[model samples]
Every structure is written in C-alpha cells, then in structure tokens.
Target: MNLLSFWIAHRADMLGAIAQHLTLTLVATIAAIAIAVPLGIVATRRPRLGTALLTFANIAQTVPSLAMFGFLVALPLLGGVGARSALLVLILYALLPIMRNTVAGIQGIDRAARDAGVALGMTPQQLLLQVELPLAMPTMVAGVRVAAVVGVGAATIAAAIGAGGLGDYIFRGLSMTEPTLILAGAVPAALLALAVDASLGWLERAMTPGAARSRRVTTRAMTVGGVVLLLIVMGGYAVSGRWGSRVIVGSKNFSEQVILGELLAQVIERTTDLSVERRLNLGGTFISDQALQSGAIDAYVEYTGTALTAIFHQPVLRDHVDVLERVTAAYAATGRAVLSPLGFNNTFAILIRAADAQRLNLTTISDAAPHTPGWKAAFGYEFLEREDGYKGLVRTYGLRFAGTPHVMDLTLSYRALAGGSVDLIAGEATSGLIKGLDLYMLEDDRRYFPPYHAIPVVRTETLAAHPELRTAIERLAGRISEEAMRQMNYDVDVSRRDVTVVAREFLDTVLQSP
Candidate 1:
C-alpha cells in the first residue's frame, strides 16, 4: 500500500517515465528497422559483404552497454549527454538482431517459389516485392520483436546519462534505498517489454501467406505505430523533465550525492525564478563531470580533493583549505566555478564490521593491519582505481588481506560488510549507512586520504546567464555541517525518507534561522 499510494501520488512522474521509455524504444527500433532492412537486403546479394556485416554487428553487440554510452558521450555533433547519445547506443544494439533476421528471412525463401516467379515473367524487383518480401515478412517481424524488447530493457540504463526513462526512478530508488521507487520504474518497463513482444508477435503471425488480405492492414498498422511513437518522442521530449524546472543539475549515483543534488535544486527553486531541472543518480564522478563539461547540466556538487586529484590529475594536498583553493583554481581554468564548501569532509574511511572491531580491539588502520591476512576486503571501483584510493592506502599501510580487494559499489559495500559477505570495505566517512547498519570506521592512522570538502561546481556561462545563482549558492556556504549531512544521509539511507522532503525540510529550517 505504501508503494501504491506513493505511485498514485506521483502518477504524473510515473506516467512521464513510461512515455519517455516508450519514445526511446520506438524511435530506436524504428530507426534500426529503417537502416537494417536495406543493409540486410544488400548483404543477401553480396556474399563477402554479408560476412563483414555480421562480424561488425557481432562486435558491436558484444560491447558492454555502459561502456558504449561512455564512448558516445565523447563523440562530436552526433553525441553528447541525452537522448541522441542514448538513441545511438540503443540503435547499435538493435541492429544485430534486425539485420541478422532480415538476411536469414530473405535467404531462407524457397528456391521453388523463386523459380516460379522467374518462370512467370517477373522482373527481379517484382519477384522481390511479390514473392521474397511476403515470404520473409514473418521472420523479419520476429527480429523486430526481439529488437524492441531489447531496447526497452536497455533504455532503463539511459537514465544514468540524463535520458529520462523508467530508469530514472530505478536509479533514484537505489540511491534512496527505497524498493517502492524501484518497482514504480521497473514493473512498468517489464510490462512494456512484454506488451511490445506480444503485439509484434501477433503482427508477425498475421503476415503469413494464408493471411494475404490482412497483410496490407497489418503493414499499415505497423507504419502507423512507428509514426505515433515518433510523435510522442517529439511532443514530450521538451516537457516532463522529471521534477525539472530548467537549469539542469546532476549528481553522482549515491545517497549523499542524490541528497546534495536535490539540495542544489531546492536552493535554486527557493532563491531564483528559474526552475531547476535535476538529472541525479548519474553513473559516477566521470559521467557527472562529462555532463557538466558538455553543458548537459548547469551545475552539480563535486568534492574538492576529487576535483584536485582524480579529475585534474594533480597530486593530493593534505590541508583542507589548500585542496579547496587548488580545486577552485583548476576548475576556474576549465570554465567551471567552484563555490564555497558545504562544510562537510567526506574522505574515504577503511571500515570494518563492528563485531570484528570489538573482538580484535581494532581502533585504527595499523591495529587492523596485522589481522588483515585472515579477513576479506572490498572497495568501490573509484577507490580501487583512484590515486587517493585503495592502491595508495595499501602501499601506505602495507595492509594485505588473504586476497585482493574486491571491487563493489560504494553504497552496497557498507551492507556487504555488515552482512558478513566481506570483512572490510572503503566507505565514505559521512555515510549514514555506517551507524545505521552498525558498521565501524577504523581510524585513518596513516592519513593517506586527503580532505574531500563538498562544493558546487557550476559552469561559468550558467552563472553569468543567471547572476542570481551566485547568491543562491552562497546561501549554502558553510551551511551543511558534517553532523547535519550525516543525519540527512541517515534520514534517507536508514530512515528511508524521501530525499526531496529531507532537502526541503532542511531548507525550511535554514531559511527560518537567524
């Protein structure tokens, strides 16, 4: 009932997600059909070309979906952040099935039927249109069915890049740790895929040779379906910005990031006339950075040390003010203005199960280092790969476990340790899940990690366009203390409260204060 009530209350968002999802699937599948059918036909005539085509399709089909999205985000004119890039990735995935089926369908035609057409004084084009296409129609439609269903599932990931779909709710749900939101997005998408499969399957059956009279009817319906989908894509593409009001804001995919993203949006809403368009739960720091740099979003919160080292590739600085100064300057050089710190330092912490800490009398990294050979450990992908992350920490502490550090999502790592799936993890200092789940943070005795004060990174152009933003952001300066942020993260991650409500309540209290 909680999920149902929430769904009903936010039916507008749910409906919009469905529309965006349908549009992405329809557009990609239709565009795939337009390209694939011709290529499939030509490949049937050219033996060598057919081999090369299949090889290329197979290679493209094998590239991971997230990697493909990242690849496209770097391409010029044709790609960036949004539906265009997502459409291209979806079309690439849709191609192999559609093309392979088209070639198979055409080549699978009976030789006797072709001979009859030739004997009946039919031209090559006439034979192809009358005999070949009709016979191949059913199989080709099967390909379309597969591609459409695949596109629907893949479209959910598109939300990671700011392309609105059922995925937006799914990612948001994961960040908030709310199963209700997940179902709100996922259940609709699954049903949509089944609906597409059934509808296309019916059409494929209707195109059989015995149903000649209904052939044109089904084909016309197919064309109409494509046109309807294209219209939906255009009509709603600009509207329904998933709680957006313009001035797009984005954030990395995690509880803290989502709350901060909403914090910025709500602050903008309260201080300025321009409505904020949020694109939160992005894949990670890189995706959020790419979106901001590409102008897909106007602003997002970034960590000072992360910007200094991870993004700028500069060496780490231990002093908090020094790291902030260097990060702000580096961002300014790249046309991004880094604002005042939000008054929280979320440096990485080596965490252990509280039980283990108590049993082993572990109070610091050095104390836990001796027993590491018996314990399993894990870290987030960013941590494992970063200059300030796992590699450096291990070298600094010489802490060796029984095996190598397992890579896991930052948020999930907390629960994994608590649940005894792993004995150790690198977690954020301010993560609410730490206290909520009874996990213990070992002291960073080596001080290997740098200060990671949170600050808003906004485009210089966006600031100039909306001068009011400077003051609005300044309102947040030195505002969110470490304790306040931890409690808010706990409210969402542990208490399971809505992020928007938490951000709004915080803002209400902040504005009412002297």
Candidate 2:
C-alpha cells in the first residue's frame, strides 16, 4: 500500500501522531520566539554580545538533534528521558534560525525610518516597538517560519527518545522495511510543514501596517482559524485519552524489536484487563531504556546484550544463561525487572560482504580488526558512537584501520555493507538484513560481544500492577530459537513481510499450540 492508503487505514494513529508532532513544534516555536527575539534585540544593541550570541546559536545547531536528545537522556539533572528532553533539544534547534532572523530583521530596518522616529521625539523603546519591530515583522516571521519547519522536521527524530510524533511511523516503517508505513508519516509531515508555513506567512502579511485593510483582516481571520483548528485537534486527542493510557509499550527502531513489542502488546491485551497502548518503533537502545525509566513507556522488549553493554558497559559474553542472570540481577537493583529471557542471542557481530570476507580471509572479529585499515567501516548511528559500541570495541581489541569509521542509519547499514561500499560493519545481529546479502558474520572467538537474549524490561511499578503480564509474555519467549529469529527477520527484512503479521503468527503458534 502507498503511504496515503496506509495513513487512511491507520487514520486514528495518524491523527494522534499529527497532534503530537504539531504540539512539539508549536511549543518549541513559541519558546524559541520568546527567547530568540529578546536575545536578538539585545544582540542588535550590543554588537559584541550579538556576535557571541550568534556564535553560540551556531554551535548549538552543530550538535545533531539526535545526539542532543541522547545527551539529555544521559543527564541526571534531566531526570532520564521523555518529552521534556525532546522539547529542550527541539528548542535548542529552533533558537539558531529564530535568533539570527530576529537580529537581521531588526537591524535590516531602514536607517532613515529610525531617524524619522527619533526626529518625531520617539524614545528608544518606542522606536523599537513602533518602527523597528513593525518594519521587521516580515523578517522575524520568516525566521519563525524557518524554525517552525525545522522544528517539525526535527520533532520526527524525537520519536527516538519516546517523544511521540510522525517519526514513529517512519521509524517503524524503516524497521519493518515497509515504504507504505514511511509514507504514512512523511506525506503528512510534508503537508504539515506547508500548512504551517502558509499560515505564518499570512499572519506576517496581515501584521504589516498600511497593507490593504481587507488583506489584513483576512490574515487575522486565517490566524484565528488556525488557532481554532489546533484547539479542535487537541480537544479530540484529549477526549480520546491518548495521554492517559495505563499501559504504553515502546520499542527501539528495528524489525525484531517492533515484532517483539507488538507481541508483548498483543499478549497483554489478550490475557490482561489493562488497555494496551503501543508506542513502538522508538529510537536507539539508550533512548528506549530512558523512555521506560521516565514513565513514557510501561514496558518493552530489549536484548540482554544491550542491557549489559550499552546500559551497564560490561563485557559481552558467549554463555547466554550466565549473561542473562548477571543482567537480570543488575537490572533488578535499579527497580527494573529483566523477565525470563527468550532462549536466543542476537548479539552484535562484524559483517562483511561475502566477496570482501573471502578477499581478506577474515573469519572473526580479530581477523577483521587488523584489516579494517584496508577498508572503510560503516556503522549504524548508535553503534558507531556509543562508548560500549564500535569506539570501545576497537580500542579494546587494539585494532587499527586506515579508513575513518563512518556512521549510517541503522536501517541502511546492512545495505551499505552488502554493496561493498563499507568493508566492515561493527554491530551486525543474527537477524540483520545482511544475512541475505551474501555476507558472513565474523566469529567473536574472544566473545567481546554479550549474549543478547530477548527479554521484556519493565519498571517495577508496572510489574506490581500487572504481575501476570510477565508470564503471559514469557510464554512466547524461548519459543523463538536462533534459527527461527533469523528466518522471521528474513521474512520482514528481506522478504518484505508485515511485522504485525509475522508477530501475530509467532504468537498464535506459541500461545495457541498445546
């Protein structure tokens, strides 16, 4: 199905997502305007301060929004992750354009006009409010326009940190390899940007004094209409209680994660009286973990390897049972429970194109480590940057490569490796799409990578409220063997099957049989 059709099919979700996307953008834009305009005004008055403020704004823009979101997630003062961190990041992003524009707009005003105001006995404040600001409205609006558009686009990435938006569909679609799902998100987002830009443009034009009075009135009417429309959207969401659900399941951006998340939601809905709210297809492992901690998500599936390496910064292991026990014990101390592991390991391994592996005689991580200098290494965003990820592993192994390790989106990492563009990929899982690309998973003889047994991680509060949810989910835990996970992964990643279908089938087979 095309994206429009997918959105139509999932209209309820699409609407909820739209509401969330707009909320983040609007809040961030208003905050940005409030702060940026004053900062811009001050900067205009003091040229030295303006340069420093502009430099700071530029620097803030340099930090990728995703990285900024991650940084916030790690901050203790930020108190874990969720919408607040996401909002802070979005505001940071919006500031640069808004601030710069405000300064430019205020400064861009005609010098003669300012002189006229002064000659007419207007005070500095009066000159600014009546002459400068009025003349600068169009420029300021343009800046806000840029910030709003950028904010909307950046807000999509907020899904990575459990900040709901259209990004949920895009990330989920990427995980499931379904273009339709992505379209469901992308199209609406594009429409939203256009709508916002046009709305703001009209407002700016209306605010321009001496413009046709009729045009001004029309612009005012349009602005009022936009506000009313937003209110209606919010009212609808409130009535639906999208924010008040008792259970919210979230997942990292990957097919297996999505499937496991759906399985958890489905099982909970079937076996428990609590309502199920799926917030699946969130971003990286850290983001999802923070989401659970911050009360954005009640529970979600995670791998033991991630909990050990990414969360705990421990060594990866070969022994699955021992690893699970250690991780469970550790997590339990944090008021989180690692439920019974589903007997399978989806640990990270190096993947190279079949041809490249043969050429290099690389059968293991150690073998490939020395030769990494010979080929460019491409990694998924999280895997490349995390301390427990490629940086740590490469340092620990004492391996040097000639080429700089490059980071790509996780969804594209396999394709890049398979196409021979990247010689080595650091964090390949058994269910990764690279399996079908004639690539081989290098052996981790020293076992630097941890066993990634799939399991559900839940806050202690959630467990206390829904004790049976764990057992119900555990029913399908070990049912998926390593080979089964590989095949199921292929079905979604390679064969292009719907994740929901695959998850439902797995659940039916495991729960309905015997």
Candidate 3:
C-alpha cells in the first residue's frame, strides 16, 4: 500500500508512536547535554578528572543497549518497565559523542586566542563565555547533532521497556511480515533524524563566525527551541501515567505475544470498567518477569516451557500437565498466579524452506542430519543460550552446521530463511509466518522438545487488588485451540490485519458462541 493509505489507516497510532519516539529521544538528548557538556568542559580544564570521566562514559557506551536497560531496571529508583529506565539508558548511550566533542572543541582552540584574551585583562569566565564559547559553538552543535541522530535510532529500542515509540510498529510489522507497517515506523524515524541533523546543521553554520547573516539564524533557533519544548511537554504526559490506571497488560516483543496481549487487553476492556494500559512490546521473558515482580506490569501471557526452563531454570519436563503444575508451583512462591492453560501449545520448531525440506525428504530432526554439515542455522539470541535450546538440540541430534550459527531476532530469522541467507531456523510452532513462508517444521522424534502451553501469569498483588480481573482473564481459558491461533496468526501476518481488530473479532465470535 502507498504511504498515504497506510497513514490514513493508522494515523492515530502512528502519530502517537512518533510523538513518543520524539519524547524519548529529546528527553534523553537534553539530559545527555546537561551531563556531558559540563563534564566535557571540566575535562578540558582538568586532565586527570577528564580522563576519569571519559573512561566512565566509555564504559557506559560499552554496555549493550538492552543489557544496560536491564541493568538499570534492577536498580532501586531506576528499576521499572517504563520511560524512566529507558530515558536513563538513552542518556548513557548518548554521553560519549557529546562529551568527547565538548572536550575536543575547547581543546582545539589556538593558544594565541587564549593569550590575547588574557592580555586584554579578561577574566577566565569572560574568556570562556565571550571568546572560547563562540569559537566552540559550532563543534558543540556538531556533537549534539550526532547524539541527536543516535538518540533517534536508539530510542526505537526503548519500546522494549514499554516505552512506546516507532519501534512498536517495527516490531509488530516484523512479526506480521508487513513491510508497510515497518516502513511506517522506520521512514518517519529516518526523516526525524535527518530533520534533526539538518536543523542542527543550519544552526551550526549560522553560529559560525564570519558567516553570512540574515534573520534565518534567529528563526531557526526559535524553531529548534519550540520543537524541544514540545517534546518535553509530551514527555511529561508519558511519565505521568496518562494511559490510565487500568490493568496493565504486558507482552514480549513478538507477534504471538502481541496477539495474546491484545486478546487479554480487549477482554478486560470488554468485561470490566477499568481501562487497560498496554505495556506491550516489552523485551524478553526475563524482562517481563522482572517487570511483573517489581509491579511495573500487572499481567502478561507466558508459555509453560519458557517459565519452566528459562525462568525457573529447571530441567525440561516430559508431560504437558506436569510442566504446567511445576511452573505454577514455582511461580506461587513468588506471589504470582499462573492461570489455567490457554489450550494451545506453541512449541519451538526447527524449520527450513518448504522446497528445501521436500527436496531433502526432511520431516524430522534426524531427517535433516545429513544436510546439517552444509547448512547454516539461524536462531534468536535467547535460543542460543537457553538450556533447552541450541546446545541440547545440537547435542541430541549430533548436528553440525557449515559455520557458527547466526544469532538474530526471531522475526529476522524468518526473513533470513525466506531470503535464503540461512538454510534453517528455529521458529515458534504457532507463528503465522511458519505457514505464510511455507516452511516445514522438523519434528522432534526423540521427544527432545517440551510442551509450551499458553497461559496467563499474573501478579498476586494485582489479583488481590482487583479479584474481578482473575475471573475476566480466566474466562479465556480453553477458548483458543492450536488451529484457531494459527489462523489468527495468519490473518495478522499474511493478511495484514490489525492485531487489535483480529483479537476483537476472535473474542467477539467466541463470546457470541454458545
């Protein structure tokens, strides 16, 4: 579809996402300037302190973005699954460029300018303000431009913490395999970055000495200042919990989780008077679990196998019922309630292109064994390290790929497999893309895989506070089947239907049924 049509279809959501994206980038960029500029100035004045500050800032840059967000989530005041932690992480990521530029801009000055100012009986502060600052403004603006652009890109990841941004659309689009949705988020973001760089570039040029003059600089300065003020005002709305005090439904950043989350949110919104705060598009199982425990989110859908192996770190169980029981018991200790199963199992399935699968006569893990040595496998980052994931599967089948496995986002794995960049991928069994892409899921003939039953795991405190929520949520138990969910997935991913619309339609049909 064209951009105009896509915009017409998703105007409100896209606009909201763009606004949040800007709020995150601007707030973080402003904070980085507040911290880094002073640090940069201080570093230029004091060599030892500058060295220490720069080292610390460098260390912050070294931490992976998601990992840094996770680390901050565990801290006392900073720990949460919202804009607060996201803002803090973005500040850390943005520090290096701004700080380094500040130091370089000041230190780049010629010694004669400093001596001349001093000889003219100017105070140190006056020299800095009048002579040095004017000279350094161009460089400082350059640094801010880099940081601002970087902030725009990095802010996309903030959606992982329920800090809504354009990344939400991108993640949803990836899961749905809809390029339009992806572009909707991506194009705006890229444009926003260019706009920032261009506007800043104009300012940088206008601020330089001996440059041609017009009323342009003043107009541009006002334009930039107005934009910054607007973002700050929008950011205040985000931080103030303007989304409402309803039951917050959280989900991992994937298609299935998004579908499931919308299901829960829609159901609650239908059955109760309370509004639902969608903290969807959260990161991994670990992040969601932390958010739940810390009360940043009240409820989310999780799989039995993920809870068993990834969360509890226990051995894989054989029986589906036994796995559910064990997982429930484990979560109970932490004052969380694991509700009844949602009647479908979304097991991890090893997949390859249907044509490749047919050519190799591959119906099971063993059938793919002969092709393994020549094939490159791709998997999500979590799958690479999970106990019940890559290591155990490779060991069980004695399979070896042509090279090291390609670790990527689960959604990217599907795209890569489709594009023939990789020969095989680990895909979730219930994913719509499995059918849409015509990939064959190789069976675990030796029972190496465990059942991943869909279930709602809610915080005990939330239940206590609103007992009706439990009743409303549990109503969905046994409502969805494997085939039903696969069809829903297909509708969203292949047919490009909206997730909320799909969920509402399904819930409508179910509720209308005898």
The top-ranked prediction according to TM-score is: 1
For all predicted structures, in order, the TM-scores are 0.93, 0.83, 0.86
- What's the lDDT for residue 314 in model 1? 94
Candidate 1's TM-score reads 0.93
Model 3, total clashes: 0
lDDT of 3 by residue, 1-514 (tens): 5767887876666666777888889889999999999999899999999999999999998888877777777687766778889899889888998999899999998899999999999999999998887888789989999999988998887777778888877766765667877888889899999988887787777777777563376576768778875875566445433565667889997878889999998888888876777778788898888889888788999999999999999998879989999999999999999998889999998999999988878899999988899999999989998988999999999999999999998987987998899999998888888888888899989888899999999999889989889888987999899898988988887777878889999999887776
Ranked candidates, highest TM-score first: 1, 3, 2
Over 188-257, each residue of candidate 2 has an lDDT whose tens digit, in order, gives 8988899888877876776676777857687678778878868857864663346554688888888878
Question: Any runs in candidate 1 off by more than 4 Å, and if so which?
Answer: 74-79, 116-122, 212-245
Residue 483, candidate 3: how far off, in angstroms?
0.5
lDDT of 2 at 101: 85
Q: Which stretches of candidate 2 lie over 4 Å from their true place?
A: 44-51, 104-132, 174-178, 235-241, 315-317, 349-411, 422-429, 432-435, 440-450
**Evaluation by TM-score, superior candidate among 1 and 3:** 1
What local lDDT does model 2 show for residue 330? 83
